[model samples]
Target: MRDDGRAILTPPARGIAHILPRDHPQRLVLNDEVHARPSEILEAPLKLSYLAVFAEGEQRADVWRRVQELAGRYGVDPAPDTANHYSANFGPFRIKCERHTEFLRLVFIVEDGRQPESFEEPALQAVPPEWLAALPGQLITAANVLLQHSDGDWPEPERIATQFFDGNALVGASIADGAAFAFTDFRIRADGFSRLLVMDHGMTPRQAGRTVQRLLEIDTYRILALLALPMAHVLAPFLAARERELAEVTRLLVEAKAPDEALLFDRLTRLEAEMESEQSRNHYRFSASVAYEALVDSRITELREERLAGLQTFREFLERRFLPAMETCRSSAASQESLSQRLTRVTQLLSTRVDITREAQTQDVLASMDRRAKLQLRLQETVEGLSIAAITYYIVGLVGYLAKGGSRAGLPIEVDLVMAASIPFVLVLTALALRHHRRKAARES
Candidate 1:
């Protein structure tokens, strides 16, 4: 026994083994010895699930009836509907059914229960002999039927169909594809011991159920990514086109072209509104992730790169081709409007432009004159200070000479008093002359 209390065995069949004590809540044990020799151990306890594929539009009733007959022979049930359509025992077996536009799927599971405490027990001795002999034939029969059904002539596109059966119930899958339809089938033995086959199909209710939880997880992410592509590619282009049209209309308005302006504006607004509504609807959102994953696969990566390159090319085309076209349209519209408008209106527009230019020139002239006046005032102040200094110097020298001569001739006058009196008079005359010079310079400049 393994540490987990499950009995392990390498049976007579190569690569096939039996795992007992399979009822544990935390672990699933498989019969691996049978897996090694797939052909010799057909009746071994199935450790893995099987998948069957069918072409789409194959008569649903016929397919169900055939499967029903097979299930009845094996003492299993055929659960049929628009969604799930296969059944298996809840004890130690797995079964599943799914349908797509071009294919159908059927899978089977086998369970090996916990080992008996002693091999001497009658139940323990009888268990292996009873189950193993019957299992292989049943699996083979079911697979053959599904294969035959797939081979039948049908109007749908030709497809390849295959099924997988594992000696151990842990891993198996099936695939079906036709020209118009494709789908995959998978089976898992739960880690927690349970006797249920999780059947999943592309219906809303199945998506919410436990059986399909993992498949749904993968599909959902892919769908989201795929949905974003059209937004960037298809819808973006439409929006850009509308934007260009609006830009043209605005350019025309700026040029005072009124003809058809209201109509163009109305059309552009309506297009924008339609684009918004389509975006809100987002019909492709669910499938986007799947598309993106499909692109990510090794075989499709080049195609995805090409699609992205195409998108870039389309963007360039819109900028280079459509934008220039819109500009031309605006130019033509403006020319036409100029011809249609009354002469008085055209003349008024021209007159408005001329008036604006003239007003700007007048402001420039007034500013220039103000600057020149300020400069003249500053020059006059500077010249007045220089003139005062020069006049004072001359007057002081004259007073000094007179004082010296008067002193020598015995005149009753102090040199300092004479110089002080002359200073004020000299300053006053200098100020007057500086003011007159500034006036003259201002008039000339």
Candidate 2:
């Protein structure tokens, strides 16, 4: 039965392989992603120092060049410019460097058998001081971690925490189901460096390396996430003022007449511009903070932490201390978005009011023009009536004089009777002639 099952699966697998005509361009890269940053093999009693720098543009190139310069001292070729991660040994100490989207992380490790009386002896002490000082970009985080074997001659967590962390309340946990125990007070000492102490209970070299890496990462990401807190604090009063200004603008828009609308619109435009600028300036920081917070939580979960007596666990400390600051950032971002949306609506309303006022004014001007045109038409009609009457009177007088002259020449007619009788006729004829002339003129025009 097993043979038959294998045979059936094999045929389909072969058929499926032939089905793809060509390989995808990114197939290899995608497949290799899981193995990108393989865990290092680390024995116990090691000291590691880590640094993260926020970098951009020429600063990034500067960091790459600086690494190359350091590599030359050890006779090793530099990592390629496109490489996101690199690791190499330089006789005295080994370094692992990784490039992130907005920052670069450098880890210096001193392997086992280099035990000092104090864990405060930093692993970074082995690197060239001048070279370390010359690193590019502003420092985002710095920490030293000491990993020790826990089989024998190990002090209690209390004594270790007191000696290394200056008696601060320690957060300790047994992670990986008791494979290792971790302790940190999460405080920066007077030396300006934080400490993490990892006790290898029974973890193999690979597990130990990963464990140490996770511990360091937790600290790194925690600080990064809190970077948004200060930005939120600064923006709080600013946002409140903006909100009040927006409310005032809205009220003005409601009470606004036509002239006031222009001013209201301008105010709305300026407010919107300010909000957009704020969003543009702080968008990346807020988003990056959220991403870093998620990483912190993920690393904490991977620790699979169980609490120790008289101490808080990693999860407990983060939940109590870190989550509230993230919430503040989120609330501030929401408020900004809401304010912007309200401003947009108010601007639209004000614009509509302005358009309606313009339309009303246009209608009034048209009505006034209609009344003037009517008055002009009435004046033209009166002048035409006077012209008709004057032209008729002159023609009638001329006809009366011609009639008198004709009678005196040779006719048995009385001039008085003729003139008197012809008066009505002349009036009628003059009117007809004037009417005909006016009709002809109208046709021609």
Candidate 3:
């Protein structure tokens, strides 16, 4: 059992092992996650450098491959690819690589018994430049950190800023409950690197290391969070134009006919695709920025910073500049989400209208078919009546010829009367027979 009342992870007691459930596939990994990327114990009078490489997309494997190659040259054992962090001793300087979601953090530490002039002799001076050049991904953040022991008195922020930061305004504070003091201008100098100066005052190596790590983390996360700002600026006008287009589409859809609705639906579908494409491009970046910003805030809080004289503190500096930019990113992302929802609603409404239009057209066609069928039936009935009359006239003419033949043979005189009597009978019989045949055909049909 551990001091925190949690049982230490180990094999179950021998007697109980047989009854215990099998371990989960990820048990060890999950248990050790909290211990990943631990801060290395650090001493004062140290030259430290941090590099954050923006490993965008699927670059983690490549980054690891390069790191492993570098390790081989230095005769250090390579870390497993699954490791979240790696550290090794390399003669003059020590290095640590920490893997994060979108960026890889490389920290170099060197013993600085004789602190050189500011960043002129940084920890990176010991690293192979060719190796660094070959490393994948672009550098997103870089900083030179100097940790010096406080002997007599604390240095003035303005003086330190002038000497190290080229007279730029500084922001820092006494941190770790006055165990140390930190100052930085947070400006990239001509050498393309920012600087942080820390003076340790009676701090244990662990506390000093934690303080430095937090400071670097704050710097890294702050910059990372601001990365979304540029995209937000570019997206603002696009969103406005899209909103206008959506409004126009809606207005045109109100009274659209069937063919017009089809055209409008096609247009709306294209617009929706554009919106989804934009969202796909920006969504992850925006969300990651928010997460990075939150990390920055959390690390700042953990620093336990106190005012160093009347100088601006790290929190104040970032709040003044960083937070507003982060908020703009959030607002832009929110606007995009809202706009996407609006587009979906409009598309759904358009689809429903199109469906209704198709249904109405189908109903109209069905009604027309019914009307045509009625007209055809009426015409057939008229034709049947004319056919029956024609048949009756022809049959009566034949009967008259037969009666005239009989009179000529002297079997029956009065041919006109006989033909006249046959007329009524023929007419009645023809009418009845035609009506019966029509009824039979109607039943069969």
Stretches of candidate 1 off by over 4 Å are: 1-75, 80-86, 89-93, 98-216, 219-232, 250-258, 273-281, 284-445
Please, what are the lDDT tens digits per residue for candidate 2 over residues 1-67? 3755654335556578767778889999999888886666788888888888888988987897898
Quick one: best lDDT, which candidate? 3
The list of candidate 2 runs beyond 4 A from truth reads: 1-19, 112-117, 152-155, 376-445
Task: Please say which candidate is ahead in TM-score: 2 or 3.
Answer: 3
lDDT of 3 by residue, 1-445 (tens): 8898999877658778677898899999899988989998888888998999989666877888788888888899998988879999887899899999888999989995875457788899889999888888988889999998887587687778778888888898988998889889888877778999998888899888888899999988888888899999999999999999999998998877777977888888988999999999999889889899999999999989999887888899989989889889999999999999999999999888878878898999999999999999899889877876788788878888888899889885687787678778887888899889879988999
Error of 3 at 35 (Å): 2.0
Name the candidate, 1 or 2, with the larger TM-score value: 2
How high is each candidate's TM-score?
0.25, 0.82, 0.85
Q: Rank the candidates by TM-score, best first.
A: 3, 2, 1
Error of 3 at 255 (Å): 6.4
Which candidate's TM-score is highest?
Answer: 3
Clashing pairs in 2: none
User: lDDT for each of the candidates?
Assistant: 0.40, 0.83, 0.88
